[model samples]
Target: MNTIDEFNIDVRALNVLLAVLDTGSVSAAAVRLGVSQSAVSHTLDRLRQSLGDPLFVKSGRGITPTRYTLQAGPHVRQLVGELRSLSVGPPFSPDEAELTFTVAANDYQRDLLLPPLMASLRETAPGIRLQVMPSGIPNPEMLRKDVCDLVISPHPPAVGDVMQRRLLDDHMTVFYDADQREAPESLADYLQSRHIGILFATGERMALEASLSTQGLSRDVAVTVSNFSGLPAFLKSTDLLATAPYRMKDHLLKGFQRAPLPFELKPFTLLMLWHQRNHEDPAHRWLRQQLIDVAQGLES
Candidate 1:
């Protein structure tokens, strides 16, 4: 008998053995694994030498497993099943879960959705903890470097491993202090007015400004702030017009009058992003669904 270590058999070789035994032929097993027929034959030969058995023999036009191979088939299948199961995480139960997750979001998203997300989690998953940080001009590294589990933003990083879904859509609207002045009368008036713009600390303009730039339009910014939270202070009792998402009317820019933009622009969608590695994780999926539900509930 040969020592099993001398042959160095691994899970792939074991799968090949089981494939041939199940299909009753080497060629069929190769087709199953997308390998060449000779490759299957070579694996069987090494497995046969390691086990001291002629695992298969010709049976008329096809092949049949020998008595030893037949006896070991079920055990090989079980071993392979157990080895494959190692890749998956254990089961998750939100009620009993004790986990912490970080989410990257700007003030608009932080105020709009996260409060509802927290309220929902408190009712269903009290054991989980949340740590939220600013997601200004979100980048793929936030997920790749484990900085955060999720990012809520209009911009999605241009990386293949990053995945995103639109949480909700909002159109650019003219926000103004009704007591100070009314919305701009026309495109010319809108373009000429003093505008309040959001410019992140890193010097990147927000999505609305960036998108407008692509279409050869620009804002005459008399005031610029680092976040959406600061826009309200600058717009009060002033003729300054701030073009922002209409959804903000009930949240950050409450009591401000809203009117449709005088010019045509595509509606911007707020998106949620995550790393591909967590796409199938049980806990991640649960939280992701929770966030989506909150966004959807707001939409409805």
Candidate 2:
């Protein structure tokens, strides 16, 4: 037998050896590989020179692998298999994948967006799991710490390598129980009204409060809550007004009435955020696109 380092080796030559051994005929192996018989024979000659083994011998009208080739066949098959696996990344198939994703969202985004997202996932990626966590004023540290895969928020991180896209822009509106009180007809009426305000964990007051403070006017905040979902309960039985996004009419403000804010408030833009590391990942891209689609559907 020749020394292992004496002759150059190639994967195609190894494959030819496996095919010849399995079929016990060069012509049949060539058919399996879509090659001419002479090509198969030439590959076999190269493999024989490299390994210094008469890998096959004539037997009647067919062929038989030598004892040496038979003894090494399985190991050779494994080596070829491993080499193939190393040649490329496996393509992503959402229908066949088993994956879990996490999202950080405030109660507003969670209630407004995720239910439709989950419903869509159920149809498109049955094997995928979803986890939603509170995203109280998202920052880059949350992503750097691997706290969540994506964040849905109105606030965007100020740090670099944090990617974002605006999902929708929503203007503030006054939500109230129509049966309890009439909608505020003027800025003076809105300011005089008792309000239920949202206080984020970060100590950043809601945009309405900031806007009012900027104009040297403020509302009588009779109650403070953390999430939009709870505003309906407070406003449902009383004359208290909840200043919330117009989109809340479909979500948290159902059975309540909403009218445009009596004063001009700059619209809030809801954004989707993710770390740079996940930007090019196929599964992450797919989920992002799914969210974009859901947002578009909601707007339409």
Which candidate number would show the highest TM-score if scored against the true structure? 2
User: Against the true structure, what is each candidate's TM-score?
Assistant: 0.69, 0.70
lDDT of each: 0.86, 0.85
Off by over 4 Å in 2: 1-88
Minimal lDDT window, size 10, model 1:
80-89
Question: Where does candidate 2 have its weakest 10-residue lDDT segment?
Answer: 81-90
lDDT tens per residue, model 1, 30-103? 87667999999999888888898999998899998889988998788777767765665778899999999999
Q: lDDT tens digits, residues 3-61, model 2?
A: 87797778888878887876678987787667999999999888888898899998898
Model 1: per-residue Cα lDDT at residue 289: 96
Output candidate 2 Cα RMSD.
19.4
Give the lDDT of residue 281 in candidate 1: 76
Instruction: Pick the lDDT winner.
Output: 1
